[model samples]
Target chain A: MGRAILTLLWKDLRVELRTKEILTTMMVLALLILVILNVAMGQNVVTVKLAASGVLWVVFTFAATLGLSRVFLVEKERGQLSGILLAPMDRSAIFLGKMIGSTILVLLVEAVALPVFVVLFNFPLGGRVGPLLLPLFLGTVGFIAVETLFSAISAQTRLREILLPLLAFPVAMPALVGAVGATAKVLDGLPLQSAAPELQLLVAFDILFVAIGLVVFEYVVEEE
Target chain B: MVQEDRRAVEARGVKKAFGRTWALRGVDLEVRPGEYLALLGPNGSGKTTLLRILATLIRPTEGNIRIFGRDPRREGEECRRLLGFVGHDSFLYGSLSVSENLHFYARLFGLPDIPARTRQVLEALGLERRAHDLVRTLSRGLQQRVAIARALLHDPILLLLDEPFTGLDAQASRSLGELLASLRQEGRAIIMATHNLNEGLEACDRAVILLDGRVARVMEGPEIRGERLREAFLATLES
Candidate 1:
């Protein structure tokens, strides 16, 4: 089981490394969102600071969705998903592998996007930035778990690009809210303890989405 | 008492429906170990659907299927281990090289000594020479060969192929025919679904014509020779 999951993850990462399809698309979109938002917001330090967490979450969510939408569609391209499904491993390994892959791509995009965001908004990046990782990481895990599952379901549809966000955003709302709230607390220079409730909510959503994904993803990918 | 005597596949009353339409109403078929069976049918005749169900890619709307006596629904992982499937598509990633694609599947199938197994299949399919080339760069025949190598990586006992010769040139088709003959000789249960009746029936011990989601006729031995199967094909569907 461990070998299968790692193999699946390695396969996805290797393909991404070669084509750079998912990561490049995600990074470009993240940067574009940052540039567009910076122009619109007009360097209002107070407004930018207040909306920073929301802006960050919005950027990550949209970019991650764009990337996640292709995660399973790549497999569908050459009917590779059927080949993988015909392999003798537990189906949930596929979900975990894709979720982790999407998480890694989203995180890499965030790593680059965060700095540009700070520079664009003229926000200081002192000790306050340290606590933001927890929410960002946890929120991504939860967000990816839901999106990866929906990505599999949506990839089978004719309108996959349009369907993924519609299906995932509603389901991933709690994690988004939790991440934004926790990020807001962090940006405010509050202690990590002050953001405990939001952190807990993020953790809860992560556990719930992952657990449900493990159980339900197989059925979603199954053909009628 | 030998494993060779056991049935490699046994499906009974298998039915599959997509909403209001039915793809397979009741498909009862069996294949012995080392036997070659061909599934022949017209468009929308449920050849692919039946293959997909036996491959466990889709559930039958009704009925039971067993791979070497193990229920596919109850023991999918084990059943999957016993079978290899090659659909119409190559199923190889265009960005990855031939060797990379095979190695990926070898690892996914949990084959021990991945390099050795990957090397063996690559050599078998005559893909070792082009192992480093990206799949998209390879000719269609080579890509299909890579797909076959990936399917055979785990050394399954049952092999299912759907329209494998659809796009092959005459030479490539001949190569595939030779490969199928060798696999059949190795005692693997083979079920090939193809529209090329001449090529499809040439190497098979038995053949079945499917129409409207049911097996309309089964031909064997001398009955499958010459123009009989083709005659039966047109006659069955026309009726």
Candidate 2:
């Protein structure tokens, strides 16, 4: 199982390295969203700082969804998912491998988007980078775990482009809300303990979805 | 070996339905070790559905399927390891080179000495010269050959091919036929679903014709001759 999971992750990364299709689109879209929001919010630094966390999530969620939707669609389009399904491993391995790949891609996009986000919003990091990384990492994993499964489920449908966001956003609302709250506290320069409630939710969300995804992903991609 | 173990595939009363429509209903079939069986039918006649079920890509809505006497429902991983499937799709990454695609599947299957196995399959398929070419840059015939090499990488006991000769020219088709004959010579049990009457009939020891998701005719040995099986196929469907 470990070897198969790693091989799948390796395959995704190797293909992406050659095409640069998913990451390039994700990064460009994230940057565009950040630039537009910065301009629209105007020169009000105080207001921007207050809204930065929510705005950041909006960028990440949309970019993450865009990338997540394509991850399975490519396999479906090329009919490679069937080939991968033929591998002699637990089907959950595919889900975990895909979720990990998505987590890495979203994080890479966030890495670039973060500096630009701070520069444009005029938000001060103030040595809070450590606290901020927690929410970003947890939040990305939480939603991606959910999105990756939905991406596989929806990739089987004809209206997958429209169906993926619809199915994912509602299921991921708790994590998204929790992530926003935690990011808000960190941006406000409050102690990380103060955001414990939201952080706890983020952690719980990550565990719940990852568990559910592993169990049900075999069924989701089974028919294909 | 046990009598059941001597059979490469055994499916009983297998039925598959998608919503209100049934693709395969009450389908019973069997193939012995070292046998080549051809499945022939019109479109929507459930050839692909049956292959997918045996491939363990999809579960039958009803009934049971066993690969080498082990049920796929209980031992899917084992069943999958014993079989290699080539559907209509090449399942190759267009951005990656031919060797890279084979290497990826080889690793996924956890084959030891990946480079040696990869090189052997490449040379066997005559893909050695084009190993470095991107899959998208290759012709459809070459891509199909690469897909076959990918299937053969794990050295499976059974091969399930669906419409493998669909779009190939005469030369490509003839070469593919030679490859299948060689694989058969090595004692692999093969179940090929094809629309090419002459190629499919000539190559199979037995042929099953499906109509409306049920086995309508089974021609064995000398009964699988070209004109006779073709007439039987048309007659079965006409009924």
Candidate 3:
């Protein structure tokens, strides 16, 4: 099962590497959001500092959605999803592989976007990258688990692009709120304990959604 | 004592409906190991729908199907392990090279020695030379060959092909027919759905004509030869 998941992840990664389809679009959109944010709020350092966490997450959420939609679109367009479904492995492996792939792409986008965001907004990190990393990881896992599942569901529909956000945003609201709160606390140089509650919420969200996705994914991919 | 033949596919009273309209009113079919059966039907004749149900891609609105004596719905994973499906679509990732696509599927099946299995399938389909080419860069024939290679990688005992020769050139089509014949000789049960009447009759040991979601006729041996098969096919449609 693990090997099957790895194979699936490897396939998605190789396709992305060759085409740069998901990464390029996500990075460009993330940069565009940053540039727009900088223009609108960069002039006021104090205000930028206060709003930096919210703006960063806003960029991440929307850019991540753009990337997530492509996670299943390639399969549908090339008819590869049927091939994957026909394989002998447990269906949940497909969900895990896609979730992990989307998580990596979202993180890669964040890796670049974070430094650019700091420079553009002139917000102080205060050597709190350690505290920030935990929430980022948890928040991303929660975000991707739900997004990947909904992306699979929406990909089957005629209005996939429009349907994805409509289905994803509502389910992902709690995780988004948790991510925003935890990020804000960390950026303010507070102790990790200060943001423990938000981290807990993010963790619970990840567990709940990941479990739901694994159990319900087989039904979602089955043709009616 | 005579040994009973293992059944590769057995379906009874299978029916599939989309909303109010029925695609397969009732389909009863059985194929033994080593049997090569060709499905013949006009447009919207439920040929693809029945094939999809056996492949476990979709469920039948009514009735039951067993692949290798295993229920496709209840034991789909087990059934899939012994099944190979080649549809009209290539099902290959266009961005990936031929070898990469095969390797990906080999690994998904968890085949031992992925490199060797990937090379073996590529060589079998005469795709080794074009192994490094992206699938979209290949000709339609080569791409379909790649699809075939991917399907045969796991050495499935039952093969389901839907219009496997839709866009092939004459040479490619002939080669594919020979390939299916050889696989049939090896005791693999094959269910092929095609519009090419002559080729279907020539390659298959038995032929079934479906019309209006039902089996209109079944032909075998000398009955599926020469002009008789074509006449029966037309007659089934007109009647």
Candidate 4:
């Protein structure tokens, strides 16, 4: 099972590396959002500080959805999902593999966007970079966990392009709120403990979705 | 040795319905070890549905199916371990190179010495030269060969092929027929669904015609001659 999951992750990463489809689209969109935020907010330190967390998450959420939707769309379009299903491994392993791939891609996009965001808005990072990493990882994992499963479900639908965000946004609201709160707290130079509640919420969200994704994934992949 | 006597595939009263439409109303089939059975049917005759059910890609709306004495629904992982399936869709990732695609499936099946296994399958399928080419860049015939290689990677006992020759030219089709013949001689059971009556009858040990979700006719040995098989297929469809 571990080998199967790793192979799946490796396959997805290799495809993305060659095509750069997911990363290119995501990075461009993130940069565009940052540019829009810069134009709308106009380098006002006080306002930028207050809106930075919210804008960053809002952009990440939408861009992540765009990337997540493609996670399974490529498989569905080429009918490769059937091949994966035919493998003699537990279906949850496929979910884990996709979730890991998506999380990595989303993080890469975030990593690129963060520096540009900081420089664009002239926002202060102070010395809180170490404390920020945990929330970023947890939040991204929680977001991708839910999005990956929902993307699979939506990919099977005729209106998948529109259906993915519709199905994912409401379910992903809690995680998004927690991420924004944690980012805001950290950016404000608050003590690590100050964002502990949001971090806990993000962790719980990740666990709940990852558990549900494992159990429900088989049914989702089944042909109607 | 005793396991060889076990039916490679067995289906009784298997029915599959999509929404209110019944693709397979009631079907019964049985294939012995080392037998190659060809499934012939017109469009919408439920041939693909039956193959999908046997592959465990979809569940039956009613009745039962057993692959090597194990129920697909109850023992899907085990059934999959014993079965290999190739359908109209190549099931290969277009963006991945041929070798990469096979390697991925080899790893998924947890086959040891992945590099060696991948090389062996590629060589068997005559895809060694094209192994590094992305699947999307290959011709349809070559892509189909890669699909067959991926399915054969795990060395399944029973192989299910749906319209395997749909897009192949005469040369590629003949090569594929030779490969299936070799596999059959090696004692692997195979069920192939196709529309080409002559090829189907030539390659298979028995031929079954499906019409309106039921087995309309079954022919074996001398009864599976090309002209007779086509006549039976036409007669069944007309009726």
Candidate 5:
């Protein structure tokens, strides 16, 4: 079961990496958002970095949604989700593989987006790397979990492009709020220890969404 | 490793319902190891629904299902390991190459020698030349062939196909028929759901006709050949 999970993840990574369509689109979206924000804020260091990271995730979340929805949506369009459902692998394994793939893609896009963000906003991320890193990882992990599960179900519907956001946003709202709170604490120069509550919220959402995805994914991927 | 007295697939009083419509009502069917069964049915006759239940993708509302002596409800993964299915939809990624798709599925099956298996499947399906072309670019016949390659990649003992001849040309269909016969020769249990009773009769050792989620009739292959099958299919549809 787990081997199939790894195989699915590997296939997604290799295919997406070679194609570079989704990743490129995401990076461009991130950079475009960063430029727009920089001009709007105009060198207000306090407001720029404080707000930029949170807002950046807003852009990343939508962009990541585009990519993540494509993950299983493409499978549905081609009817490969049915093919995969027929495979001898566990459905939870399919869920984990998709979650892992989406998580890695979002993280890759953010890795570049983060540095560009520091450059645009003129923040001292080097010294704050330890503090700043925690939010990025926790926030993305939670976002991926929530988006992946909802996207799986939405992929089956006719209005999939519109449906994913409708289903995902309500569930993802709590995670987004927790992420913004945690990142704000990090940006304000609070130690990870002081930011424990928000981090706990993020972690809690991660576990919750993952559990939900694992349990319900079978229904989402069931044959038509 | 074959278990004596083991039926390949057994479903007793299987019932599947979606909303108020009953797709399968008290369907009980079985195929012993190495037996080929042809499930003939008119449109909306529950063949697809029954196939899904056997694959463990859907559970019957009231009845029990056992595959290879393991309960699909409790041991779905174990049951899955022994079966493969292909429906009307090819269920393949349109963006990936034929080789890549097969390779990926083989890897997912955790089959030994991924590259060799990919090559073997592609060669078998006559997909060698177009191995690197994306599936979106392939014609309908080619894509369906890749679907068969995918279903057979795991070397399962029990294979189910739904209307496998839907979009094939004469040459492709003949090749597929040969492949099915070979699989039968290897003692693999095969079951197929087809609107084309002629094709189903030609392909399997046993034939069944389903009318509105019920088994209308069943006959061994030799008993339902040629014009007799055509007449039966017509009479069933009219009734």
Candidate 6:
């Protein structure tokens, strides 16, 4: 099992690195959203840019959905699900590898985007930023798990690329709400204890979404 | 009917329906160890449906299936470990090179000496030269060969092949024929669902004809030859 997960993870990570499809597109999209934010917030003076941090995180979360769907699009287009299913490993391992791969891709974009946002918006990203990282990571985990499973399920259906976000974002609203709420506190200099419930909610979202995905994976893999 | 005979795999009065469309209307058949059985039928005749039931991919609406005396419905995970399937499309991840695909599955099957086993399977399938090639870059025949290798990696005792010969050329089909024969020699029971009647009979010890989701007839040995098997397939289709 360990070997299977590692190999699967290695395969996804390696291909993603070579093609640079997921990271490049997502990073560019994140940057573009920041550009739009600068223009829109330029007209306002109510600390809209500061509030835009939460807005920007939401934007990244939603935009990352596109990258997630595209990641699996190659596999589905090439009929590679059958290949993964036949790999003689626990099907859950594939789900985990995909989740990890997308999570890393999202984080890569996040790393660069944060510094750029801090520099451009000038909101002092270090105001208890150490604590804020927790929500970002939790939200990313939940977001990726939901997206990975939906990608697998939607891969078979028609309009797969469109269907992924439709299924993912609606089912993921709870995590989204929790991350936004918890992050607002982290950026405002609250202690870790103040952010605990929302953090816990994100964790619950991760665990529950993963469990649901694992249960339905066999059905999605079965040839209809 | 649960025949008291020594059966390697058996399905009794199995029925499955998807929505209002009934795919199988009580499919009952049995094969003992080492038997090569071909399931012949036209599309919508329920060949794949019955195979999936035996594979425990879905439950039969009404009926039971046992493989080696174990109820597949109740013991799907165990049944899965003992069974291998190769279908029309090989489900090899195109991004992963051949060796990585083999190694990944080896780990999934929890095999010790994964490198050795993967190497052996690749060599046996004559894929050693292309083991580093991405599956997307391989020819259809080569990809199907890799699909067969994926199935054989676990050394399953029972094999279910759905249209396994679809994209293969003569040589690839012959190699596959040889592989199944070798498995039969080692006491494995095989079930291949195919539309190609001629090749189906040539590869199997018995050919069972299914008509609109039921077993219509069974032919064995010398009766399964040349155009004769195709005629049987047509008869099943007509019925």
- Residues A99-182, candidate 4: write the lDDT tens digits: 999999999998888888888999867697788888888889998998999999999888987898898889988998999899
Candidate number that wins on DockQ, 5 or 6: 5
What TM value does model 5 have? 0.90
Please, what are the lDDT tens digits per residue for candidate 3 over residues B189-227?
899997778664476889999998999999999878888
Across residues B40-146, which tens digit of lDDT does each residue of candidate 2 receive?
A: 89899999999999999999998988899899989999999899999999989998899889988998898999999999999999999999999999998999999
**What is candidate 4's TM-score for chain B alone?**
0.97
Residue B177 CA displacement from its true place in model 3, Å: 0.8
- What is the C-alpha lDDT profile of model 4 across B40-137, one tens digit per residue? 88889999999999999999999999999999888999999989999888889888889889988988888899899899999999999998998999
Local error of candidate 3 at residue B179 (angstroms):
0.7
TM-scores for all predictions: 0.97, 0.97, 0.97, 0.97, 0.90, 0.87
Per-residue CA lDDT of model 3 for A98-164, tens digit only, reads 9999999999999999999888888768688878999888998999999999999999888988899
Give the CA lDDT, 0 to 100, for residue A125 in model 4.
Answer: 78
lDDT of 1 at A27: 96
Over all chains combined, what TM-score does candidate 4 have? 0.97
Query: Going through the candidates in order, what fraction of the true interface contacts does each contain?
Result: 0.84, 0.84, 0.82, 0.90, 0.66, 0.34
State which docking tier applies to candidate 5.
medium
Q: Which stretch of 10 consecutive residues in model 3 chain A shows the poorest summed lDDT?
A: A41-50
lDDT of 2 by residue, A38-151 (tens): 889986978887788999999999999999999999899889999999988899999999999989999999999999987887776879999899998999999999999999
lDDT-sorted candidate list, best first: 2, 4, 1, 3, 5, 6
Task: For candidate 3, give the lDDT.
Answer: 0.89
Instruction: Give the docking tier of candidate 4.
Output: high
Every candidate's DockQ is: 0.85, 0.79, 0.83, 0.85, 0.55, 0.40
Candidate 3's iRMSD: 0.8
Q: What is the lDDT of residue A86 in candidate 2?
A: 94
The runs of at least 3 residues in candidate 4 whose Cα sits more than 4 Å from the true structure, single-residue gaps closed, are B1-3
Off by over 4 Å in 5: A35-50, A119-126, A156-159, B1-4, B128-130
